[model samples]
Target chain A: MTLPRRGPWRIVFVAALVVAAVIFVIPFVWLVSASLREPGYVFSTGLLPLPFHPENYREAFQAVPLPLWLFNSAVVGTAAAVSVTLSSAWVAFGFAYFRFPGRDLLFGLVLATMMLPFAVTMIPTYLIWSELKLTDTQVPLWAGNLFGSAFYIFLLRQFLLSLPRELFEAARVDGASYPALFWRVAFPLIRPALLVVLVFEFKASWTDLVKPLIYLRDESLFTLPRGLKVVLDRFGVRRRAGLAHRARGQRHRHDPDDHRVLPRPAPLHRRHRDHGPQGLSRARSGPCGRRGRWPSGSPRPAPPWSSGSGP
Target chain B: MAAPRRRPTLARREARWGVLFLAPWLVGFLVFYAGPMVASLWLSFTDYDIVNPPRFVGLDNYRQMLADPMVARSLRNTVYYTVLHVPLTMAISLGLALLLNRVGRLSGFFRTVFYLPVMTPAVAVGILFLLLLNTQDGLVNGFLGWFGIDGPSWTTDPAWVMPGIVLMSLWSLGSTVVIYLAALQNVPRELHEAATVDGAGSWQRFRSVTLPMISGALFFTLIVNTIAALQMFTEVYTMFFGNQSTQQRFDADASTFYVIYLFQQAFQFLHMGFASALAWLLFLVILVITVVQLRLSKRWVYYESEES
Candidate 1:
């Protein structure tokens, strides 16, 4: 324990690592806990609830049209991912592996967009989409990905450049056209990079709340984030009713008064007859908040979608 | 090794194939990028609200933004966020990369663990943080109690709000770590061997040799990171803080950033001319800062196969 014997650096390093790990871990655990807290107590209750409210998850499911939004996100993100991957890989093979005219100048133009602020093009893109009659559809989200983003093309080109020249030469010897070589040979080799593009693009499109909020106005066409936005806007009388159901269903207790915790009187959930004033409000409050796949804070995406703001 | 006549044919063929393949991205850039950019610049000079036929008002919008205080504050906050977040992220990611490089057991597992956050949809990540950072009974405050620390109400508190964004930003530092890890692999073993032979310890070697070797990557990440931070939108606007109307919820003078204001002006208020003007200003700021960085990079950014 002497200063000469024990280095403080070891202690600090371990502490930093441990704290970072805890910082990462606790929130995920708390999210799951918050989602399951009793309907009355969920928001009112802290991160650690004594009892699990199974109903919160059930209520969350009912509140949002989960299946449809999820399906919408999947279809949009997946289609975008697939098309972008192909386009990027093909374009990258040309940029990286081949010696071409105007290649550097062309790439310079493409790279220039990497610095583009969406503000520059957002309005014009909107006008274009409207004129194309594609403003309200999922087309805005997916179609751009098909054309291959300059970013992915650049990243893939960097990767392809590092690869050896022998493989492409071998493919060409067999009379493979550039397309055939790209598809049959280089494609499989670059599959790992392709996967990276897939996951990244998928995440980009999947979590893209702003564009969807703008383009897709129909409630039926709403994505998960868009649906959750509705829940975020409400500061209503039912806040108490929402908490009341959570209080009764909640298992653990550090707080003494569940009644005082809620902002308003508990609204009744028709299913929770025993838990009075809980079910009715939630039924009307709709599919939102700390539970199931959707979670809360998303229900009322401010009318800025078509007008602007969410992105 | 081939015939001399074949060289021209080879170059011609490659040129043809390259254009054919690059056609998609070129077309995309022309239509989506160049076209929009030029149109946006034109719109900046005129009063166009998407509905109105653009009326040329000269430099009026730019003049208005010059007087707007919100634009300045937003830029300040964004710079503040970048200043705080980028170094913290780079340090943490570099540290993680070093640890992963040394450790033999479960390195991939750690890598995977670090990256798990990337899988969660961003809004889900935001909502999840809403619960964790809740002031009253949130887990953060609860845990802070064990250490005699009182956690601030993250989202609601203006002072602490960007700090929450910083924390949220770090959760996705997985990508940064990956980039660092790849750069670390390219460090020449012989250079390290020479340094060690000169009686350099691990820390000394890292400082003198490893650091210089990774300067290329370091420069790339710095520019890319700064650019990303400058363009930061969704997480701040969607989760921790919001843009425009939400700014009205707190009011404009309180604590919003420039990008957020630009977003509000362009989208919410339908101040297309003003927004376009603001966009041009931002473009200039980014362009100027980047050129300065590039010019300054002469001192530190070293490449192995390039002119000194």
Candidate 2:
């Protein structure tokens, strides 16, 4: 255990660590460099931001409602975090403090729910929201957290269990009411664990794309992830535009009307249409290169569908 | 008699308080989880689009799924991802954690650096990796080219798609590393010292002293990462299929994980009943895998209480 700190091994270890750290970090570095490049040079084989076009940021915001999406994400993340933290804490406290019949069984059920895939509950949950006329609204995104999440409940319960039962017993002996024992005694004591749950749930909510994709059909109501999805769909083919421009040997100018390079948004009603299985089949067989599809005449991007041949 | 009666009432009061505290979860369990579960199970048995009343069509959805090539394709894709992603992530994270445990002065800085990726939103990670994994001009390929390695077309080739996704998932191995670091820290230092005194080599000491102590965390991560890899959706969906509004181009069949297929069935195709069946199948697969893991854990997962 007392191996000498200063040695050839030490130098090797530090070098390895540095290499690993750089490997992990290079993606963000590349993204930043790519973001600053001229549209034509974005797919160019360089890591530096040569011919920097900071206007890409301004154009991106204008192209999509970034600020609105950010605000919506913050709101949804906050609501989900706060509600899940409080509710899960309350439920955890109950399980931790209580001595009642079926408590173990109920707690076991809560733990079991963690293993149940969301896909199992997804459809009927959608149905329930639809029945309540809450679809396309933000209500379905965070409102479900009012009923404590099983994972958070299990987490907080473990935290609560670590607390001394004597502390709660002392409060009860002081003629403190049950609710007072929870709010006054236990809640403050579990603040750190509650913060953990809050942060985890908030991150989950912020990063979540599935719920938003399923529920928030309205562009204005979109969370960041959903909004980003829209951005990806609309601008996914921008690389093709870059390729086309490059093929013609034209230097790309950063144009304000670059948004026009995107296909027009489908009409709201038509975009939201409920395509049945038949429509799905038809769409599946439809022509390529529309929307997020690879633009037809351009050289195909490397990855997913393309062969290994360099474009 | 009076004393006994008071005892009963006191116990009753505590029970009532317990029920009151637990009421929210109980209601949530029933309304959100239990009710929907039952409804979905029923829905799986019927033929229902959102617009129409469900018509009973027992076993038809399940039968269709058996014949559905996409179902098999998606399952194979998911399993491929899980098999690759889980073990590689575990090994890499554990290795990082072990190294972090050795460092004294700069461990916190390194840990923070490693964990920064875990905080990046999945959608952002997807986009970032999408760009970074591009074969022709990607930074990854550019880096590989430094060693004269020709990187495969990551997102484009069906053969390499899952591997690409695995690489992307590895980028967020920070959380797993952090978990392992915590577990490594908890492995009593004295045990390692004792093993050293007993003439055990560093490798031997680690294999015996270090691993068993952290087996619980390792097992927990295994189950969690397995479940997560199976349900892998957001990043893959974002990278490959996020732009479904576009016309059908080349099929990224390998990228279509099970959940993505379920999502398309339910939302895009409005085949709610069929989607429900797909979901239930996933549920059963997850259940079986989890059960198998739990059973297997008894052999290797160490619990301090059991020795006591």
Candidate 3:
């Protein structure tokens, strides 16, 4: 029997959905408004900008090497995604198509690796990269991925396992080589899973800040996330006077501003004014107050626990 | 006898092909994952500062963690995030999925709209929230102003920092919603129809019928979401402590997640040994929680194949 489709239920459902939809878009709408906002007026409460200044995008490009950062992100992300997709597909092909001794046990190990936390391996990996002289370059960012990630392998294998065994057997009976079958038949059939791997890796590489932070030291090599972090730190709402300096730099100089947003080499008034009288006094005291300490002058205090080189 | 003879040789040939095809992952597994994992365990006992050779210091780092204030603080913050984030995300995602399922014709369009936020990079989302949650001029606070309510200083105020993160985490609920929607679609319509005939109201029918059918997906999302929430890092890192300025420290207590603290120990302070210990500790915690979740799931999670 057909149930009543029209009633209070329909109205309530529509109303609830409309509210949820608006909530989902609020941050996005604000991002657009803030990005288009006037240079100094970076924060905007409205959903839409009143006096839309699209020039902030231009200023942002000039302020940091936006195009270079995007290019770096693309190169790293694309390389990692491409490598991961190819390698994982190759590995998955073997697991799906073969019935070898210890295959199940080996595949189990692969699955186990997915749960292995980055924290456990990050330090040693960094050390290995440093030893190889791969640190401070983009090599560390995508090098590990050239082998393949466990999740992608597992995902592709599951997809491969679901396919009819007859297809592979037929190809093998025709005297097709394993690699030839993988390229001609398996690869085309598993396009969707491959796309998922590619998209996931690309997004991951694009958004990653920690890897770049741990590895890349030079400004020229920074990806978009790292570059954005630099921008936010230098020019967030708390630091109003920073925009003033940028504004001045735009007017006075033909060359790019030499100021790197570091602790000013000299404690100039511009730096002190932002921190106020109390901050200036702390800066004078040499130790710099704990709340406002910059790592530049004050060497990081050794943790109390580090005194254990053995008695 | 002839079939058995051919089988052995064919199996041998296939195994060889498998090994050849698997070479890339085999090399990767050895170099990237397995080697580093073993090295990490060893390094956890030695004090290494890339500049100098590691000096052996057995249990010192682990012992020190027992007294580290930041360790306690970050753990508390991480647990707090996981506890709130997982359930809230699950509820919101399921709710959105239910709503979208009801709005059957527009599911495709609405699904894209909802999923867009998940596609945006986490860094961009974090940066956007930094603006949206600004105390004075943020859209969130602005909207609050409409009701004559003053919003909390979200990122700046320690009290509101976790809530701010929780709010930001909700923006990416689109992925989870899509998963739940897929599960909902797979729920047999005949069951719902049967429930309706039995005089069960919509809500009643949902509670009794739909819930049990999609319990497997529900359980999967819950465990995955919980694991992710425990490892919350990138958004909080970019939003709060990622200072490129000479002063790398930002004293936002509520925002100091466990992974972030571990990262600071490893990279910022060069405490490689101590950080490895922290990493192992985190892994142990995750392993235990996952095991507990699996044990608990036996009572509630429904498997269709097991029914017969």
Candidate 4:
């Protein structure tokens, strides 16, 4: 299509795009704003953060085991990405370059496996891992990638199919080992597909919540998403009417709803003190104010009732 | 290109190399995927808790699933979500792609901006959107307030929870948009020019020339988005009830998706047998839907190279 040559239509087109972009970006902008703001200003509606506290990130780090969680996420993500990419490329090359019996059938089988959803195999797979004492470890999460994934293999095979077969033949004739031919010739030619596999596998591992939720028991072993869940559950406001009711200044001071929204900073800080140096600060800037739940007066959470104690 | 040198020994060795290369994946399939598939099928017919040996129950688990209210609710919720989500996502992604395709110079910049959402971790997106869709101080409600419209309590209200999740799901339209963009760019410009010369207007040219070329991508995104919507978990899980506490509970009734219920049955409740039956049912549903989609694609999906 021709450009509209600086007409009003062009301006309208650009303006519409800008609006869409802003709408897409507002969540991220809110995350950044909420993360940076002082605990008191979290309920503020304005976009630009007032009394910006970059220290909340430091406190966020202190509040939870952020470093450990980040580290675990990296390890699993990298392992899955690297293993999936290499194995998928290796398997794809075998299918693409070699003229073997059952090659088409085997590749078809690989594609067919993609149809089976994870839930179908999830329970038995977990049992197998548990039986092998692999549960509660990071192994189960990334080990599946050691055997080439069906989707990645299919993707790489399609890419390999497009490349001239001559490259592999030429490399083979040059006295190169079969493995060497794959590594030197086929692997380099399929770099884009490999990169795609790497990114896909990394992101899949990084954001996976179910596998970790099932496999991991130890809090120390949790990944970022798991840790984030812990933080949200611990600090998030729960009542359905909390945010809206509080916003209108109609909230009763002694109501149970009030306790769910307000963060009792001193007690929370004291609790965090046992965990780490910055736990208190983390609690102060936690999911409470980010929720914009309460306008005032912090309510203390009731202590858990002891067994055999009557209400 | 190398010459077709058919050395007898080398050809024989190539077959050996091929099997050797396939061995890793083959072993993986047997041990991980194939083995578990069989095991789960067996497990579905029995009462199995993780701690004890599985006992044969002879379709009891499946029978129980038929009676379970949550199973029906979950299925209804999943179907509702998939029905709403897949079509809306297709429309939005296609619209974005068409918009990006028309804007010449800044398309690259806008494309990057649009694609940014897909790169953010899904868990992070969930949490971010949870806050963004809050009833009172959320950016969404704040925007709605500008027009004097009171936004529903998105996060907490059972009625609005799935809609909130669906809106959040739209943020990850980047990958679909990219696929559509690639397909859009591939539509033969000659077809457009010819149609224009034939006095076809822009909409008519697009309908007759552009859409047919991109039908393959449309078919692909449809199948993918449907399958994905059926498995909706992380976003809804994070937004409504986190994993920390009440990990067993499907808090908001409307947001209890099929996969999430399956997950709770297997892990939280330790009803592995029942969950397996639920899973097999899900498998059948997906298989049927996919087969139906593939069948339906013959009607609308245009392949440029196919002989009529």
Stretches of model 4 off by over 4 angstroms after superposition: A1-6, A237-311, B1-11, B243-251
Q: DockQ (Cα-based) per candidate?
A: 0.29, 0.40, 0.45, 0.36
Every candidate's chain B TM-score? 0.88, 0.96, 0.95, 0.94
Model 1 lDDT at residue B150: 87
Tens digits of lDDT, candidate 4, B1-308: 24555566677888998999999999999988899999999999987756456788887777677766778899999998898899999999998888788777787888888899988877678777766776766788898999999998786666887788888999888889989988988887778778888999988987878888899999999999999899888887766543322222224567789998787667654667878999999999999999999999999999978956
TM-score of each: 0.80, 0.88, 0.88, 0.86
lDDT winner, 1 or 3: 3
- lDDT (10s digit) by residue, model 2, range B1-308: 69868988988988999999999999999998899899999999987766557778888788778877778999999999999999999999999888777765667888888998999988888877776776666678887899999988786667887888898999899989999989988877788889888999988988998899999999999999999888988888777674443223335676889998888778765667888999999999998999999999999999987996
Tens-digit lDDT track for model 2 on A1-311? Answer: 33325777767767777888988877777677777777767756667876777777777776668899999999999999999998988898899898899999999999888888999999898888888989778989999999898888888888888889899899888999988988999899989989999999999999999899888766899998887766666555454222211110023223322212234445655444311112222333463222322222222242232222111
TM-score of chain A of each: 0.72, 0.78, 0.78, 0.76
Candidate 1 vs candidate 3: the DockQ winner is 3
**Candidates by DockQ, descending order:** 3, 2, 4, 1
- True contacts reproduced, candidate 1: 0.37
lDDT (C-alpha, whole model) for all candidates: 0.66, 0.78, 0.75, 0.75
Q: Which candidate's DockQ is highest?
A: 3
| Poorly placed runs, candidate 2 (over 4 Å) | A1-6, A239-311, B1-4, B244-247
lDDT of 3 by residue, A121-190 (tens): 8888887887897877999999888787899999999999999999988998898888889998899999
| lDDT tens digits by residue: candidate 1, A177-259 | 88898888788877888899998998888887767755665557767666554344221113322321122223323333221
Write down the TM-score for model 3: 0.88
iRMS of candidate 2, Å: 7.4
lDDT of 1 by residue, B217-286 (tens): 8888888888778877665555433311222233233235567667656654456677888888888877
Q: Which residue pairs in candidate 4 collide?
A: none
